[model samples]
Target: MGIRLMALALIPMLPHLPFGQSSLSTSPLGIGTVKWGRTEGLKHAPFSLPDDATLHQLLDAAEAAGINVLDSAPAYGLAESRLGSLLASRPNRFHVFTKAGESFSHGASFWDFSESAIRRSVENSLRLLRTDRLDAVTLHCPRHDLSVLSQSDAPAVLSSLKSEGKILLSGFSVMSLDAGLLAVPHFDYLMVAWNPGFLEHQPVIEAAALARKGILLKKVLSSGSFTSVSPAESLRAARNLPGNPVILAGTINPHHLRDNIAALT
Candidate 1:
């Protein structure tokens, strides 16, 4: 049976990423969990991590708004473990997307895309997330670009894990147009940055769409720096992009979540 997403609001599904390669009905707007844990290497003004109560409230608000996907990464500090504990009661209700190849330590980010490191990272993510399998696992390429896929064992490792049922999908996340385009034909889906001010990655989105691959967009708010444009308008513009990519918005406030959902609707 397909994993059904239970929500109080109606959530529209994007075109099947590659049309039946897998069975994942993704919501256009996903919740980003960076602020649920990590404190360093953030672009937004410094703020306190939400307490458990606040986090629970945020989750509730997200579910009510039909936001089913939660994007987390090891570099986000305690986000994975916290989500594991909080959602332990109903893990199947949401699609859990995470990353390998990047981690945080001493308030700094690190990279590891080797064969053994990628395998170990996938295992660790499974253990921490309290789920036997992850919905999607992407290479968290920050310092490197598409070359990382060829120079390292990340591709083969991710492919092996998918065969083993450790993850449902494998993809790439990067910050550059050339790299993003280079990665399009290499993975199942992609996570790229797009907004009104930053249109450098527009070609990447177009290419991914032509390939019929799934796409997840990050930095929709430009790290909370939307000056002239409102968040709602920005989200509306992203939805109209090629492939109808899923937009990941990182916000700790429930009110903001509602506003974002409103824009997408």
Candidate 2:
């Protein structure tokens, strides 16, 4: 058979093998809290607060189902606060990853990628999460000015935080390969969206693997286009990748979270 046809035939069996599974082998699948405590009145959704009771239930469900990594951001309004309150008394095994760059305003959000902004955002995340430090803090997308992150200065800042024991890992989220490759050497992890509809990122995934950087797969559900592939299929595809370890799917529903966990199992 031709090489192209041979590779195509292997696609169906990719998920059955163990490839990207090791990255997450030590960590449970992640849950993104973007919608938690989010309101719709802002540019995207403003003045929104997720119901505390509902959020608590969701956290409980996630924990019960063995999800240990929870990702949030300051731009996510009250999400960090809610997560902090919910998991405060729980065990410390849960990994919380947050982002810097954007802040919430009156019915809108704005980006602030200045050094001051990065410092303040990390401080705020520590305060809101009720923790002394964070497990991971990503760049949370490219800056509004589109200025590339300075490798020398950026690493210094994140290294300073590491020295202070405030953050365990520093990474960035990028929509394009150029940004991803730019941040790779400076950061420890890279969160990128990878789904069938957005296969443009396949090369990025391969590059990250070659770089030995940890890869966090986001938007695996393609923003509710679950009909294209099941969660198991998504997990399988991620596992087949060279270095992808964790895949995060956002959902406020406990049942959906459980279903996602089932796919990994």
Candidate 3:
């Protein structure tokens, strides 16, 4: 896309939610940082983390392209810390969205949705991200059932954090519709998967939109499963979906970043 299209007008803004003294308004597209830190247990080809200079360039490109939201997680290896260091000198330029309830260690992933675990995770994220108040944080639900939220007090912990002003928006990320349905009432936003090849989460998206909650679409490119379709096509499909969800693209290449932004046009 041209520089003109790369302005803040490229993507439509989602409805704002009251967050303390200010409100939260996110772009229709966000840059996912899974590849920013870890490289194990991924479907993509083997790759290494970019150097500081390269990451700085990528952040520059993203900001110049009008992307103001970033998705990260504790399970994403050193993504949060690296991002924290990179963003330390440049604070409040982007809305940093992270997760709790999951962590990565010894080259394997682990899940813990207990109230204490969630609280500890959020606190660690705050220290690592170098921010006093998180723009948004959600429970990282790796399970396929509602037990992750229903059986545990993770959602309540997020609520408490929000009450204390430690975080602005709270939500959950799930892989199943049932879990998404359960999360709707508890979260101010949701991170769910949706792409052309998979539409199982359509009901969840519709329901969240109908409820007037923010929706973030993950795996929109199916983790590079867009063999038969272009990335733009997948993004366009997401834009047409309910809630005008923010499509999170996890591309590390600068060229691909621009291409993804162009796709939104």
Candidate 4:
């Protein structure tokens, strides 16, 4: 299995992406805000929800640090709305990527891959995000097999939305490597859970890069647990693979944000 890693320096060669032409950060480190206004749900329950002022302050600090990419999802309560409100006030200041296909209700997760659901999801995101067109929308980590996702009409619906200029690209935040490999060729990008300790995604990550598909990465801190490892080690031996991934570091803590930024520059 031969692997050829692409350089992060090749981002300039990428075609004009839907992310508006703004003076955004060149670093692949992005701010992932899952705890903005969200709490009492998700993997770890009872997470603290920051006040609106604090949220605004965090965004200001992130942008001031040249981290302009944001990753959000409907499952993350208050994340989309809070980021939307802030980003609306400053258009093109951040490249916001959101998710569909999976949503939460009453602390339970639900999967909806129907064509109508996908359409509705995109529309809702556009409305909540306060953007005329979204930069990118992922499949929100569908747990079903590839056959189910492939059989669904959701992809066609997203493609239609893309043609209509409502969204720039369709992709997935994949949890299953099999699904990720099977699904990557059909979409514009895929965000895989990656960290120095997790090696399960290396093949799929490299494959996506080899296919010339865009890639985003999550779990930079192993889902917010950075104990047991040093930042320097993770930064060095962590991404020893082909191509560069925009690491979505979800942290409202300024110190963690600074450390995430250090992972790149």
Best by TM-score: 1
lDDT of 4 by residue, 93-212 (tens): 777889888888787778888888888988999999998899888888656657545687877777898899999878777878888888777777778887878879778788888886
What's the true lDDT of residue 50 in model 1? 89
Per-residue alpha-carbon lDDT of candidate 1 for residues 120-236, written as tens digits (9 for 90 to 100): 899999999998888899899975575676688898889999999999899999767778888888788989889999988889888988888888999989889879999999999
Ranking by lDDT: 1, 3, 4, 2
Highest lDDT model number: 1
lDDT of 3 by residue, 1-265 (tens): 6674565344333433332223776667788999998999888888998888878867877776667889999999989999999998877888999999888889888888887898888889999999888989978887555887768888888889999999999978877888898778778888888888888988989888888788889998889866787898998889888775788889788778877877775
Q: How many Å off is the CA of 223 in candidate 4?
A: 0.8
lDDT of 2 by residue, 53-132 (tens): 76766666665555677889998878888878888778585788898877777767777666677888899899989989
Q: lDDT score, residue 177, model 3?
A: 86
lDDT of candidates 1 onward, in order: 0.83, 0.69, 0.82, 0.71
Clashes of 1: 0
> Candidate 3, clashing residue pairs?
none
Error of 4 at 161 (Å): 1.1
* Weakest ten-residue segment in model 2 by summed lDDT: 12-21
